[model samples]
Target: MLAGHAASGQAPGTGPGAAPPTTVAAIQQLDRVEVAGRHYDNAVGSTDAASQGTIRAELLKSRPALRPGEVLEFVPGVIVTQHSGDGKANQYFLRGFNLDHGTDFATFVNGLPVNLPTHGHGQGYSDLNFLIPELVDRIEYRKGPYFAQTGDFSAAGSADILYRTTLDEPLAALTLGQRKYQRLVGAGSSELGQGLKLLGAVELLHNDGPWTVPEQLRKANAVLTLSDGSRAEGWSTSLMAYDATWTSTDQIPQRAIEAGFDRFGSLDPTDGGNTRRSSLSGEWHRRTDTGATKVAAYAIDYRLRLFSNFTYALERPATGDQFSQQDERTVFGLGASHAVDHTLGGLPARSEVGLQLRHDRIRVGLFDTQARQTIGTTRDDKVRQTLLGVYGQTAVELAPWLRGIVGLRADQARFKVNSLADSANSGASSDHLLSPKLSLILGPWDKTEWFVNAGRGFHSNDARGTTATVDPKTGDPVDKVAGLVAARGMELGMRTEWFTGLQSSLALWKLDVDSELVYVGDAGATEANRPSTRRGVEWNNRYVPRPWLLVDADLAWTRARFADASPAGNRIPNAVDRVASVAVTARELGPWSACIQWRYLGSGALIEDNSVRSSSSLTTNLRLGRRLTPKAELTLDVFNLFDRRVNDIEYFYESQLPGEAAPVADKHVHPAEPRTIRLMLQLGF
Candidate 1:
């Protein structure tokens, strides 16, 4: 059975040992409310505007995602796009923040953190290629920094993905698409004696994109799980493994493409990557009449070798500017939370406490390369990072129509680095931070509620940046950066279900960061420094007029800028100004079903001066399906329905070409894939 409240607006199940309702009508009564089983609810009178609400499994199954990570696009006001090969992490944009490789946004799967601190590629690097979309049961997302349970990399928002413990029936699927794409997947679950269950899944995939140099991507993934009991009181253990290798087609200079060069051509064919990950995780939960307790632990072994040549021949003209970033690490973490219900001043109340601890031992390096062969090392370091966090929160019902939540959190992080390039740069650093949070919820009058929220959050800097005393390229002294960057946010919002079969929400939010500063260890330099501010508004609507049809629309607009004046101007580079999406889906319509969606990403400044900007991109997709038999189905997906010509990503930078006299500043972009189609066959037993 699935967890969470029923979509039909029925009351949730009572806790263990509770008396069952006498009649079906009593079970469906809206007035008979139960304590929220999960953190948030999506019923008519539940949820605030800052919450996307719980995305049910049925909805996830109805939507068609081109990439596994694109499933997150269901979160309102978020956009996912890719600039390189499919094996790499997708670029993310939300609430006016670029969120490069998930710097400020946090993501999790089954209580396991996805962001990697002190990473080789970028800070808080997040890769989601290991996710198996078909096994996902629910997605709960929250925006802003208003929750105590969220810690690092959650200043922008956070998402928790849950997978089903057991499948109703075994499944097998095969997909074939344009550009030589192929995939095979199988999953199943079996019940053991005395409430024990076993589940397993495996996937294989390959793809060669439309680039002149084929991507030649090959990926393999597997998962195994064991569980017992219900979600409210249960324990589960899981093991996962993933491996992939691919040839990349990096972004190209617009000048070259306009000068008769093939748009799909690559300047360096050796630019690609290989990565692997294996992990074991376990989660346990216990619930009583008045409270609940939960615990989780995980360990991961990961490695990556990435080759990139973004600048052509700019830095090492002789070596063609190609470089390699290697990372090998082991991560371990533990988390526990306890919640109890009580009375405060004769009013209903709840108190919760949580602790989180994580440690990473890593060997990371950056080296100049030619034809995938290392020429000279820029920096190589062995780093150890440890983080500990504890938090407490209380929720009180001040009045029949009012509720308030107050929280406090403290976090400490320690970093130790051993630099191989320069002994002088090796050192240790530590930092601590405190955050306060508050949220006020107003009446559910006429099926609507208003909310006000404010909070503080943070993200940790790379360990190498925090301990460095000198530059690796030049032996010049350099000041160490702060180990943690702080962020503050406030929001006012409302959620309403005043209309029949319709739900709508709106939020006005603002966020400020102390500084947008980062150390680029790969380049042996530091990024530009500037404090930044962002304000945005989002509107989301969902309508289900009929049992078989659903419609959704989300729109957002933002204004972002630097807080201090500078010669380069005040605009924040790559901070998107607007985004919109609309989707319509129909299912179980006499053996025929269909879905169509449209997404738009507005243009933004590509440089600090705002002198150059990227063009907006719009794409439409359609999915059609037919029920061949009771246990079999076929689906056809058409991507880029209109064959739109657009860019997946754009940047403004200086580069030197083979025949250029000096370096030239120009726009570089990765063109979006054109029209394509995929066919899939699914079988269930």
Candidate 2:
């Protein structure tokens, strides 16, 4: 089966049998090593924290993902769900925080950043619809703010998804499912003369979900990559393009459900979105026995048109409170890093320095809409933003049984805004920040190691918020907010492989943020929130009881609250407290393979006062694959296998029905899909 886990081998910190000094070149070399028959890759010695690891392609290929964004679920504590149409960005929850369209989490594909700093939808908005899972080579993830290579939107964690330069065999696949779902994909690679290789993939998909209005989701995506040489010395260039459009079935109020509304019903059939993106990226790296150097650059063009009506008639009784958001942007970025191996005070050591630069030109607008037609404009603005970050890090063997890592980073941001509707809101601002990080590793006694880490990190806020002085929609006086928010984090963790065929890790961590201020693009205003604090514990285990069977389980719990006192109480709304997942896979059982997975998301407070709460949910998925011939195979996938009646997402807000005299407070929810099945036929040459 495609579902498997690897914990990597254990190595000492500073003894005669200790692992090599950690460096960019060494890590790249490690990644090049083949793991053809291995179920998991060893991370015990190569990782600085127990929470850091890599998921290989062998495992990613076998997992059943209902949506493209669900690929991130393999990261362990992360949960991905959608509240609207399939074309919209997926909502993410991790480490007790509702990420809200990818805030506080940094994501990179082929070294190109995915999070947009000043977006029309929200701050740090990220969309991964363009990704082709079949082309991914591996996913490298690090939790917390402990790594120097990461910068903005990394206060929570970061992930780097690397694509393969070549495919083992060419593939063509077709998938069909219930609700008129259809997909066609083709991928292949060719070796050019003189060590050059070209890889390409294309996908076309359509789905009309189990909704009364019919989603009518249409999408097209493609990727092309060209490369020469290997990890020791190589250069590669890639091009990606994606376009999508869909109708929406947004969340409905509980009152509507009680009034004979279908679970897969729509509040506003006109609510939907269309988006397009294209990018060109290049990367080059050279590695030697003593050092390594790498450089990357990218340019992107993006556009989005979205319409949504969340509160119904709460704000505009005459128009039904519908609004539209539009964004168009061009982005350019460059990054370079160098690492050297040397001796510090007669001890083995490695040092690295890096620089990152990015610039964005954006045109964003908001409008009042009715039935997909614009009525009046709320605000329109042209924004120019630039970001720069520089960092240095060093690792030294302090003792035969101890190792230390230290780093420092500096960041600066500048924003210029030209408000088209209100001249008073046009202005320019700049901000800078300094952060420090430290980590210590001790002993591999009895195949176990302990780690302590502390660091400071940050996320950039929307550029418009740094200059606006009045509410765009209400014309009320407002205060400009900071351009960047800071966060501090610390973790104590351990990893052990004392028992044969079993790997385990445990971590205790805490984090504090200076503020939770965010710019609401939908409302055309800034909402300042109080400071917040959070603490959590996690345990992850992988065991292979037999050569044919693999079992993996992960559990996490967190406590989240506002740092300041208030009459409304300190509970941080939507901060889920518990999450768990279990998976079992059986492989090499003749020509048949099978996998089963269970996921749970615990309830959380819905409001600050804790007077209301959301419900928990549990769901299971199943997959079966059979080999039909040497070059052909068939597979079946089942989603929500038990047909549980649950919600994908929930919110508490005020809205008014068609005949209501006053707005009413109630819970709004997007129900999870019922049991569905899909079948696929794959051919390889």
Best by TM-score: 2
* Candidate 1 lDDT over residue span 413-513, tens digit each: 99999998888878999999999988887767776778898999999999988878777878788878888899999999887767776777889999999
lDDT of 2 by residue, 1-685 (tens): 0001212110100001111234211111112112223534544555678887777777776768889888888887888888888898888888888888888988877667888888888888889888888888777777898877778898988877778889999999999999999999999999999999999999999999889999999999999999898867888888999999999888899989988989798878899999999999888777666666777788999999999998888778887888988999999998877767788888778787888889999999889999989998888999999999888888777765577889898989999999998988899999999889998877666667788989999999888889999998778999999998999999999987777767788989998999988889888888999999999999988777787777878899999999999999999888999988898988768888888999898899989998989999999999899989988889899999999999998888888876689998899999988998999999999
- Stretches of candidate 1 off by over 4 Å are 1-41
Candidate 2 is scored at a TM of 0.95
Positional deviation of residue 642's Cα in model 2 after best superposition, in angstroms: 0.4
lDDT of 2 at 295: 77
Query: Candidate 2 local accuracy as lDDT?
Result: 0.82
